[model samples]
Target chain A: MQYDFEEILETIKMTEIEHFDIRTVTLGISLRDCVDRNIEVTKQKIYDKILKYGKNHVKYASQIERQYGIKIANKRVSITPASIPFDSFKLDEFVEVARVLDKAAAEIGIDYLAGYSALVQKGMTNGERELIKSIPIALSETQRVCSSINVASTKAGINMDAVLMMSDVIKETAERTKDKDSIGCAKLVVFCNVPEDNPFVAGAFHGVSEPEVVLNVGISGPGVVLDAIKSAGKIDLQQLAEVIKKTVFKITRAGELIGREVASKHGIPFGIVDISLAPTPAPGDSIGDILKAMGVEDVGAPGTTAALAMLNDSVKKAGLMASSSVGGMSGAFIPVSEDQAMIDAVERGNLSLEKLEAMTSVCSVGLDMIAIPGDTPSTTIAGIIADECAIGIINDKTTSARLIPAYGKKLGDYIDYGGLLGKAPIMDVRNLSSNNFVGRGGRIPAPVRSLTN
Target chain B: MFISYFGKLKGKKVKLSESEIRAIAMQAINELGDNANPELVKEVVEKAIKNSEYVPIPETQSQTTGRVILTSFGLNHPGIVSNVTKVLSDANCDITDLSQKLMGDFYTMIIMLDISNSPKDLSEIQNDLNVVAEKMKIKVYLQHEDLFRFMHRV
Candidate 1:
């Protein structure tokens, strides 16, 4: 036999019992050429382009899934940032684009279509300003359109003006969709140094430099990593890291193969395989569970950051060795709602907002899928976004805030969207005011680290 | 022939046989006539290659033998192997290897099959096996060999 019996059994066990699966196979279609002078013509072009390239996205993904017997969780799409091509549009016109995106997503049979976005890391254009203003209405009105705003980067510094506007946008999005526990906020992400090739939704966008169409994948297998760690009980940190790397390497290889296969099926170029160990709401598929298995008492324990740093590092090292096309946010995601154990920690008071922020410093993204009190002021939200941006710029890594201020919901309450978004306990946010600091709207000059040249 | 010739030329390390190069040169001469300088011959050859239909290699064709691992398990009972193999035989699948283990009334069997020659695809075969599994009260899984090879073999 070419493969050992135990090896075959292990592969089967990972898929069947360990919750190992490809998190998403996101098809990135560029809409740069879809722009037109007339809003109606532009909408038609956008719709036609998406349908032409993406009509078979779900069908092809399912066929590949059946052939490999590995489940692909989500078949989604990302487009070029709307502000880039449709920069001449007004606020209402941008909302119309979002509606078309939502309709195309439904027609193509996908749950989410991202890249209803603006990249204002350095500054904003009049169109970008209008697009940012339209996000709340676009999100409130559409079902599948996910929006993101990039407000900071290492080279361009933090766009405090964009950050403040996004803060208000998040608040308004929550308020407008209050009927559904502010679910609109769940689909909005505020990013710092956002990856152009990120396959993960609520933050994914087809970078300007990308080809006309591409397929990027996000791999998820925290359950597999957790099992490997539990089985390697009593080992030293070095050996434990080896276990994680081995597990992550195999999964990354599998992920790359699946990504290539899906792209080949689409007859488009294969982008990158993001090795982020994105957690789901399932029981064993929690990054927090992996952290606990690594000897943390809970997610907020003193040694939690060290454990996460080691795990995130091992994942990247293994992923680099496994595949050369690794891009996107290739680290462990600590979203409060998506991971069951993380949610439990928040509900039990073992995990707090501050600890999560600290964890984000070493991980892929920041303050993800967290539900806070409705009355948490926009200035405080801006303060939170600024803090996350500071960490990202200083470290020169990608960070984001997907803070959902569930309208009228306070601490001790829960915002349960169920399914993949899962549920998050309304975390406590300090009442400290940042009205004076964020009130001064200007770009934070690029940090000294940005002077790499 | 023209595509392979053009592909080799594009690499700029021409390893064509004498006859092949002569054929290309003759064609270039025929096309360029009195204008057949080195650069003109090159341009004519390039245009001919571009105009020819270039068929891309089919990506779905597996580089390795199209083998699949089918694993089935259930309470130990008679006729499980016979019934399952019946489906494979019906699909014209070649069972290359088989192993079975019984651990106190529970039976697990792993079968290696070459399905490249089968008329039905993997999904169709799975659907057939699923019916047998449901009737016999067992669990069966069919997965491509590449998945195992990629994960376990470096």
Candidate 2:
């Protein structure tokens, strides 16, 4: 195809000015066939498949990044949820398998490999139970491995049992890595209706239904969108949304092009384009910056949810228009720790944990990368997850909570994840107890679409 | 017939901007029908060269081999280019292209370098570049070509 000179220049300008980047190129490798009665055999199979499929993925990603003059920010590997592959393994064996995944990822220079995960939305299988139990040690001991648990879905209703269990797991994970300000909690995510082919961590895992190997791309362009909004200067809400949609179309188109090329190069089927406006710690690249550009002085002010709802829908609309294979969690990500502006807002008391939770109902993921007080009860954590999950269940949307109980750190303290994870201000959580509410642990029952809330 | 062809393309199959397609169309028209005198061409070329130091007209698209684009962002200051390029030249890396512009106080410069013949890997060279960036109180991003293509174009 003939290249457009202006478009080429526009790209150079975007890269130079805006922090536009292909956020991640994640290769989802399925390990369903790795299951064996002998856990050792299963572990070997997992390692062998990862090494075989992942050896040249990062090498190719780097080469392509250079060849195109675009930044491929991260190269990752997502495997089928480990729980499904080792239903017979004990807790320590699950830890051992997580070690194998972690070691293989490090060997291949993968930024993060996600799969120390389980799907227990309805109820927990023995395998899922063991994996959930093993998560505290598995995540605390590993460097590059991320774990996610799905405990609720619209179709299957809310799994209150799994929600309570995952809440306890989060606390355990925080306590085990307390010295590093609960860094392990940062790597662990609890989800409701998680996307099967998401490329972003710490919620990415190859779904049971996905192909054996697939390449999924997550495109990030919050800075680009925010720049567009700023240049258009105080337009009506409709026009503002139009600006976001057009910008996202351009971003998603670029993502589709790169994703297909990468997939073709690897001889693997291409998966969806997750057009999430993922932010870094850079000055201009922030979701809070985008919100402020939309005239919200504070990110979590009263109209924030409405603004977020519009932003999220506009992103999805443009993404679908730009790519035929748009899926995953394609919306505005409001992860508190990753966004510098959000962290600033929280520190200044303009944003709070409750507001963040409310915003998640309208955005992509749920209460993400939020650091609550060290003394916050595990039941409170479960209560928060249950609330987010209830929202996801009713709306038939994906929601997640990656709350870090900055162990021994209070609301005023900050935990520095460093690099892309950014710094998180420990925001105050409501002291209202929900232990009895979560204690009635069954399912929250499916939403009645006929009776909309 | 040629005019009609373009007219139909306006409503139907033309994906490129009219100007871009027009450039190609004009070139085709000249190549297919026009005749030019070699003597006149040579005389004009020689006259232009005699008037100034011989600067070769680069091909429409410059060929790139193992090119890395490094962008430096910071408050505008003197000698930014000279100092940064000095580092590259000292490392024996060839600067294939350089462009810079100032918008307000922020000076952004993009340098495209040929690193195929470099003695050190890009990562090691980035460390050296980082030192210069740190000293200048600027952030320098070294990126590959895909970043530009994947961000800007479909």
Candidate 3:
């Protein structure tokens, strides 16, 4: 036999028992050429291009899923940032573009279409400012379009003005979709040093430098890693890291194979395989469980950051060895709502917003999928965004805030969107003001590390 | 003989006649004009040859090994293997290897098959096996062999 009996069984066990699966196979279609002087023409071109490349995206992905036994969780699309090519559009025009994107996504039968975005890590162009202003209305009106704004980078410093505006935008989006428990906010991300080829939606965009069309895959299997840890009981930290690297290498290889096959089917270029340990809400498929298995009592425990740092490092090391094309946020994600164990930790008061912020410094992304009181002031949100940006800039890693200030929801309440977005408990926030600091509204100059070049 | 000689010159198995080769040279000359050096002429000739003979092979041809691993397990029954093999034979699938083990009253069987020559694709064969498994109250999983090789091998 070409494969050992145990090897065959292990492959089956990963898919059937552990929740090992490709998190997303995002088809990135560039809309750089879709711009036109007329807003209607621009919308039509965007819709047509997406349809031409993406009409069979879900079909091809499902076929590949069946061919292999591994399930692909999401078949999504990302486009060139709207504010880039269509820089002449106003707020209303951008909103119109978002609606057309929603229609195209629905037509092609994908759940989310990202890249309704602007990258203003330095300063905003007039169109970028207008597009940022239109996010609340666009998100409120469209069911499947997701928006992100890059407000800071290590080289460009923190764009304090953009951060402040995004804070207000997040608040307004939360209020606009308050009827659905601020679901609009759930579809928005404020990023620092966001990756262009990221396959995960809500933060994914077809970076300007990316090719006309590409396929990137995000692989998630925290359950597989957790199982490996549980089975490797009593091993020291170094030995445990070996176990994680071995398990992640196998999964990342499988992810790359699947990604290449899908890209071949689309007749497009395969981009990258993001080896992030993204957890779903499914039982036993939680990153928090992995941390617990690493001997942390709960997520907010004192040793949590160390454990996450080791886990994130081990994942990256293994991914690098397994696939040469590892990009995006290639570490562990700790989204509060998307992982069941993390939600349980927050509810039990074992995890706090502050601890999540700390954990983000060592992990893939920052303060993801967290719900706070609706009345939490925009300045406070700006403060949180700035703190995350500070960590990202100093460390020179990608950090983002997908915060849902659940409108009219307070502490002890929950915002449940169910199925992948899962549910987030509204956690307590400090009432301390940042009015004077954020009100200054100037770029935080690039840190000393930016002098590396 | 002429086609093979020309194919050997280009280092590709693409068939071309003497007249076809002359036409390609003529086209390259017309395209490149006076700037054409020997290296540039060779490059244009190769591209023209590729364009003339390109058939756009289906994406699946290069990726698929056409080998699949079919694993089925359920409570021990009288004709479990027969029913599964019947479907494979009907689909023109060539079973390369087979193994089975029975622990107590439950049986697990793994079959390696080369379905390259099959009239039906993997999905259709899977659907056919699914029907058989449903009738027999067994669980069947058909996956491409590359998945296992990629995961288990380096």
TM-score of chain A of each: 0.99, 0.98, 0.99
State each model's CA lDDT, in order.
0.92, 0.83, 0.93
Ranking by lDDT: 3, 1, 2
Each candidate's DockQ score against the native complex?
A: 0.45, 0.12, 0.52
iRMS, candidate 2, in Å: value is 8.4
For model 2, the superposed segments whose C-alpha errors exceed 4 Å read A1-6, B1-154
TM-score of model number 1: 0.91
For model 3, give the RMSD to the true fold: 5.8
Q: Please list the Cα RMSD from the true structure of every candidate, rounded to 1 decimal place.
A: 5.9, 15.4, 5.8
lDDT of 3 by residue, A375-422 (tens): 999999999999999999999999999999999989999999989999
Measured by lDDT, the strongest candidate is 3
DockQ of 3: 0.52
Candidate 3 lDDT over B79-148, as tens digits, reads 9999999999999999999999899999989999999999999999999999999999999999999999
For candidate 2, lDDT tens digit of each residue in A342-420?
Answer: 9889989999777888898899988889899989999999999999999899888999999998889996899997999
- What C-alpha lDDT does candidate 2 achieve relative to the native structure? 0.83
Give the lowest summed-lDDT range of ten residues in model 2 chain A: A1-10
